[model samples]
Target: MTRRSASTGRWTGSSRCCPLKTRPVCRSQNPRSSNEPLAQGSPASCTAAVPGRERKSRQAGRPDVTKLLVLGAGGQVGWELVRSLQPLGEVVACDRRRADLSEPATLGALVADVKPAVVVNAAAYTAVDRAEQEFDLAQTVNGVAPGILAQAARSAGALFVHYSTDYVFDGSGHEPRKESAPVAPVNAYGRSKRAGEERVAAAGGDWLVLRTSWVYAARGQNFVRTMLRLAAERESLRVVDDQVGAPTSARLIADASAQLIRQALDERSRGSFGSELLHLCAAGETSWHGFAAAILEGWRELAGADSLKLRELAAIPTRDYPTPAARPLNSRLDCTRLEERYDLRLPDWRAGLMLVLAELARKD
Candidate 1:
């Protein structure tokens, strides 16, 4: 419970540190690399980790997408993907309110009803704080549902895309993690996401899993928006500054997913990417402190009010401020495969945040 200024890159007071002593932590405190030697800047680039690759084109006469289905349409990433994919086809988006994931029999039935050319699963149970007590629900939506949807996609002869979290890793790597890095999720939420990845992957439905980190959007209830709101209401706020990660905008995920989906469809004839996971977030990385500062800068520009002042923001380790789940210290993921396969080059997080918040300012 703290306040932050979207207009100024500053805060007052601080939160508590993490209680666990895992590894030498990263600024993001992703479950992975909690003990690895820390890198001071963006995670180092790594080799592509897509397990199977050999370029192939889609059926020669593959029609441009005429219909699409997006699950978890209300989530930040799902919301963005639905809008972005509209250009390729008729998008039918669904959230828990509109549909229930626990009843996969029902979800599968719904997919069949749509018979979409492409299926995007963006819905997930993301209450990391609450997930400690709701592991079953997280598994039901984040794990079980994707597997069922993949089956439906396979039966319908449609390509499937699933969104995952960086939480899948144990965060032991000092360097950025490759897609194939051994996973040892420290939290229940991470465990559920990893399970979903494995379940959907085993189902084998011409699928692509894109794992992302620190997801936020201007309109959504994300870190960026939360920090902004806090800044507006109070003089000081405490954030877990030690946790290092790339603050990804949902818009970026949507844009990259759309681009890669198109690439996968086109490569059906020479399948270079499929039934594999990819990393799709911003290019560079930063700590939560850096991200908050950037968002505030954008807010000021948008509001045309730079007069606001902020008290010194304090940074402390995760132990100082505990959450319900154990987050990975290094939330970083390697995107070389994504870059090579889709020819997509994502911008750094700061740049993307500015773009997102500028638009958010207009809305406010």
Candidate 2:
């Protein structure tokens, strides 16, 4: 798979594409467009045809019928959502160019124009360190934009699906943070996201705010890809050992989201769509250092690349490699609420990591 780095803004290659859940082709927002279109690098047609599955679903008396409007259809989660949500309905995927979150005022008009039955927003100002200096821009995109989307969804009587971060917490306490835990963001990015979550709740009709942590993807720039790239280049790596959280896969997140959406659709008449916030993440936890070591170990075992130049990987504290913005020491999030509500549980972080590493090895 290929990924564009979010931190360095560089392109890197390593793994195969994530497993796709196929479905029938749907009408596109722009029929004559590529997945990576120009015009300010906006997202192109995000729909992909899977005639086999579509026919099967129809035969089963459950037709693919919903109209899904996906924002940030080019990002990690958004990209996977395009594939996973296809079986559910017609997907109109738009990238930043089509549904720019920074332009909050224009979002309402865009959502209204689409008038989709379901609106899933997977975009945000994700540059954590950069956000410290660009707080205004971050607030506009991460805070104001969600409310606009939520309002639009409410007006259209659509189910609003949003992804949030674990940064909403201040990283205090040793135990996993629950959905009812008090929020105390210690950084600009966290603050902005928390604001967005609140706004969504206030503006919501049927909505779900899914909070996740340490999100990685087989195709996107994430911790897994970063670790692999670094190991290839450097002989030694020093990673933070203090901060801990599950390194969740974007693929897993997208699949879980689709499942939750299906459940919501089926139980809407039973008042299952009441405004709710749930933590959706991989099981177990580890520090950045532990995660890196696991990635390397998985690669070595799966790829048989023990001849790599990398020799040592040292564990360091957060203070040793400080960034502009502060990070939570404890990023662990309790997924009990999500499990109870959706009747699903995520795989452990190590399991997901192994799958990604295997994909990477196969691609190489």
Candidate 3:
């Protein structure tokens, strides 16, 4: 469905490609007048200015209030980012309707019109198997659009933040991969994401590329929710045991991003801000079979055993479950750089799982 902005008289494209719907603009700490509508443009814009309030000096250890633009605002991470980033400054959140990634040409205009201090892109073409048949579409949204956004951010003098995946590595070694590790993607989706990373880096300004693995949330279509649905429908299930990675929560990623953005802003104030590429995920690792088992176990604890029909959970190798794209056997990523630079400690995978399960339980 297409939507036209009342002020711009421009049509926002359909949501056929984008999975998430647009969320309302979040103005938690916004200094702007409550009745003033958001600025009309390609991606939409929100001003941070208060009509009569005087601008504060930065010398008092307080960063200047800035405007932040968040693309993919309807996504799992994007949804949380709207909430998490609200305290930082004025948040202009956009979903596919406000900012369509497939139309790369329009994206530059969106950034230019917004002229935000920070640009966070959480939207992506995440269909792994489908990407094999729709490589061009995936490449356009996941690969091409990011470069344009990064360039726009550079031109606008804004910090660009993008998320990547562990699939960039060809599942060769058993150990976790460092940010410096060589990349050789085995699937189309991975190739597109890798291409995005390369392009973002090539654009070169204040930028950050965070690589994460097995992301999930209380909402959205992810492995955790899929397992829960399947468990209630089937008596037994089979999951691949060969592939392993951390099950990072969208909430964790959002919170960490806020912290990173805050630090980046502080460093910028001190003229020490620099671009970075880091791995961000949960602390530990587990195979898909193990993750499924843990998910069921946690669900049972929260919703009781009768809530699911699942009786047996079978573990099988990757070969037994062939797909349109090959998955990385070793999806591990070493987040030492992130930890050291940010002085943050990531929680274990199970801890994150339980929190999500509890949220789901409360929803029920």
Q: What RMSD, rounded to one decimal, does every model reach?
A: 12.3, 9.1, 10.0
Rank by TM-score, descending? 3, 2, 1
Q: Global lDDT for candidate 1?
A: 0.66
Candidate 2 on 1-364: residue-level lDDT in tens? 1111211011011111110011111112121233433223233433323222332222232334557888877677887888888888778887766666766777777667665667899877676666688888878778888999999988877889988889999998889999999999998878988999999999959999999888777666566776777688778877778888888887888889999897887677455456799998899998878888888888888767673567988887777665667788899999988886777767888887887777778788
Q: Which ten residues in a row have the lowest lDDT in candidate 1?
A: 7-16
Candidate 2 Cα errors over 4 Å, as ranges: 1-64
Please give the distance, in angstroms, between residue 265's alpha carbon in candidate 3 and its true position after superposition.
0.8
Model 2's lDDT to the true fold? 0.72
**Candidate 3 local lDDT, residue 255:** 86
lDDT measured at residue 302 in model 2 versus the true structure, 0 to 100? 76
Tens digits of per-residue lDDT, candidate 1, 12-77, equal 000011222221221221222223322211111211112222223245433444556776565567
* Top-TM-score structure, candidate number: 3
Q: Which pairs in model 3 have colliding backbones?
A: none
Model 3 spans with C-alpha error above 4 angstroms: 1-41, 45-64
Clash count, predicted structure 2? 2
Top candidate on lDDT is 3
